[model samples]
Target: MDTTVAADHAKLAEELPLDQIDVSDPALYQQDVWRPYFRRLRRDAPVHYCAESPVGPFWSITKHKDIVDVEVNHRVFSSSSTLGGIVLRDRPADLELPMFIAMDPPKHEAQRKVVQPIVSPENLDNLKDLIRGRIRTTLDSLPIGETFDWVDRVSIELTAQMLATLFDFPFEDRRKLSFWSDASTALPYAGTIVESEEQREEIFRECLGYFMTLWNERVNAEPRPDLISMLAHGEATRTMSPREFLGNILLLIVGGNDTTRNSMSGGVLFLSQNPEEFAKLRARPELVDSMVPEIIRYQTPIAYMRRTALEDAEIGGKTIRKSEKVAMWYISGNRDEDAIEEPDRFLIDRPRPRQHLSFGFGIHRCVGKHLAEMQLKLLWEDILRRGWTIEVLGEPKRVFSSFIHGFTEMRVRISEPR
Candidate 1:
């Protein structure tokens, strides 16, 4: 961000009335100027309320400890899809998709357990060689000395392949995984990837139909290690309705694709912008161990997680009434100064890099976190070994969403060939 523009934002943030501060605008994230607004919110009102917005009324929890308090008290802060799922915007009544993440209590636990083995320490160990081989092949194929989209060629492709592997989906059709994941989270605004809810529903039906074929094939077969097979054979998930099945499939797809993919693009961008940190990392390749989590904390792929208050609750001394929405802004919490030292700096060598809220907290904490970390750790390790000089040509085209904080395009070039 330009110094003058940043100053202007800070000025506006201070001048704006407390009631007029709405951080829910997708533009704030798309333009990459959300810092000042969030900084003001953290300082002034950690549990701030916006009574009106495009996404409707909601409260924002900006501080780290406050966000964690909401996360741990999932009973009070309900994630029920009926109340309004995990995003600030409520899905249209007819199009509601009830996945386990949006369910409360025993149901959430039962369904979550069905897919837990996919990221088991044993499964992750089994996947190491496969993941590394794919990473090697993808890295080796980058166009030397030419500018290209890191998001498409590297980030999306790599994670798509991983998602395909996890679900045992058709490898040749792997790009569909990313396409459907995008559609699943896209805001139905004019000129956006998804233009309307009807279009989104059409895309959802297509995704569900494709996955249903695999489900039928797997459900009748012997149990296997793949996610589809696991779900098909697991007592809790085997009899899920078509909509519930689709919902879980979309959840796994987004969970698998976004976190690792965006972090991959973010690592390259962050390192390019901070040459000193990049130089230090290059000098000590072992720093990849800590750098991986730092990338996640800084990028914060999924910006916020929404939960509705089941009853009156106190957070940061504010009362949240029954059935009202609350957004735990992980992006803001990760940058909370009280929780993280030098919160805004992209420091890879922080003593406790993994303590951030990118993967969230409590039972709803990302089940694939270790897998995401392993993917990043392996990619960075390989990048160091290959010695390619990557440079970001310009600012990335960010996703037009406050929910999925990611890049749509990040142009980069290998300035020096390996």
Candidate 2:
């Protein structure tokens, strides 16, 4: 965390007010020293307000219970794009793209149901064999005893393959999905990913053009099992406008890519950092079941989800006025001591590990939650079954976004295959 960019932007003096703290600073997360920052908030001011910052003023809800309260009460805090959608940065009014997750119920529920069957129990059962096969194929292809970017070789590859399967996207061109997902969330200030807003929008436009080709094809084809087909044929979603469909396509792509990929990449790095935990897992391989959820909790892929106050509401003793942007910092809540005992440490086996907010909660609680978990569970199951262990060769290059909390590259080597 040497001279981190976040600390510089969020310059604070000893006497500075807590409202001056801006957790939306991407550098804090990029440097991975946001623990103390969030810890300070949870201890001193659970529902603190930042009067102003790069992404604008918003109340930072750091407590787990408080975030859950806001999530469950969607009426008071709307997930509508007319307000601000989910992220702290409000969408441009002129270019507003409406996705089902960003919409309230009735319409939201209607659109979400079309894709729900794709990740349902039966669909996961259908996807399990495909996911496991990809995991096996991907791991076996890694070079033995050679340093490589785990995020590229394993994380992105596996997740992108799944995304391609979901949208029935072209396998060779599947990397485009990851590219668009990255571009969608990369803030203009985050120099590491997309350099500017123009660049981001250009990538997004390209993404829409490519997906529109598939949308046209899917609309004519007989109903299939993939997401695009589900949306094309489903009663509620089939009538969506082009931009609305593009919005949902981007949503599914990002949702499918970020969380599981980061957890996959992060889990390997975690074991390397905690060798004893690695040994413990090797000794008790069944812990992968527990470890999967713990990894999701630990990494907390999407850092925060924003909601606009629909009415005057009180939370954590703060009176949030109507139409004010309120950000539920899921990353902070996942690490809140009140929520999880020994929140700092990454313990593979923990009681009620799934209680964390990695997949979020309420109506917008990740439609692909089951699919993401299956991808991870099958991954570790394969790793443990083969008695292989990966060792981190260098520190990870994290994604430069407070929103999509994840890795871009992680150097590692296959250390043992006994």
Candidate 3:
């Protein structure tokens, strides 16, 4: 974003009537000027309502405490796909699919349990060396003193590799995992992967067809630890419908890809912007323990998770009626002053760094969070060991979406290994 545009957004956020201020505009996130708008909402109306947006009318839960209240009270606030699913925009009936994340209690728990073993402590311990080896290879292959996109070269590559391993996906076709993941969440915007909803569905059909082939093979064979096999063999997921199968596949792909990939890219950008923190990390490498969660908090990979009100509920002294949509702005909540100290600054060694809502809370909390953290810890540890100095070459080109708060490109150059 340029100086003029940023100034204009700041001005609009400050002077616009409270009801007219719509933080749902994708432009605010694309230009990386969302802080002012969210700051205004958090300060004045933590449970603010927008009567209009490109999507539709919805209530914004901006504060830390308020967002948690909504997340925990799942009975009142439903994540059911039949009630428009977990994103602010309602998908067309044909587009809607019954993923576990978008389901309510008993069903959600049963389906979620099917894949829980993939990230179990023993499994992660088994996968550690493989993750570290991949990270080392990726870092070692970067061109010294030459500018490159860290998002593609490092972040996407590493996460795609890991996602492939988790699914036991064909090693040669790993990039397809990322392409499908991007297509799954992509909206019809300029520079977006899919041109229209029809096109997006076309891509999903291809994904479903490919995965169904794998599912057939896995289902017929003896059980194994891969996600597809686990789903095929597990009692809860074995009887899933085709659409439900596709939905769960997309859910796992997006959950695995977006959270870790975006945060990896964001960490590089954050450290570049905060050189003093980078110096702190270099001087005391042990700070990586604290720095990992701090990165997730500061980056806030997925911006918000939407839930439909199952019944009238009071939050922040306001009544939200049944069927009204509410956006739990994790991005805003992570920076709430009442929750986090010096919310704007990127602190590498902050105490209680994991208090933020990046991985969410309550029963719907991220299942793969420990795996994500381990990947980050291993990657940063390898960088420190390599003694490589990474220099940011330009401002990151952010994803043009309100939902997925992420980067598309981040140019950087690595110094010669010390």
Candidate 2 per-residue C-alpha lDDT over 310-353 given as tens digits, one digit per residue, 9 for 90 to 100: 99999999899998999999999999888789998999888888
TM-score of 1: 0.98
Q: Give the Cα-based TM-score of candidate 3 against the true structure.
A: 0.98
User: For candidate 1, lDDT tens digit of each residue in 1-418?
Assistant: 5678778878999999988999989888888888889999999998999998988999999999999999999989999888898999998787889999999999999999999999999999999999999999999999988889999999999999999999999999999999999999998879877999999989999998999999999999999899999989999999999999999999999999999999999999999999999889989988999899999999999999999999999999999999999999999999999999999999989999998999999999999999999999999888888877789997899988899999999999986542
Please report how far candidate 1 places residue 122 from its true position, in Å: 0.9
Highest lDDT model number: 1
lDDT of 2: 0.87
TM-score of each: 0.98, 0.95, 0.98
RMSD of each: 1.0, 2.3, 1.0
lDDT of each: 0.93, 0.87, 0.93
Deviating ranges (above 4 Å) for candidate 1: 2-4
lDDT of 3 by residue, 214-319 (tens): 9999999999999999999999999999999999999999999999999999888899889999989999999999999999999999899999998999999999
Q: Which ten residues in a row have the lowest lDDT in candidate 2?
A: 6-15
Clashing pairs in 3: none
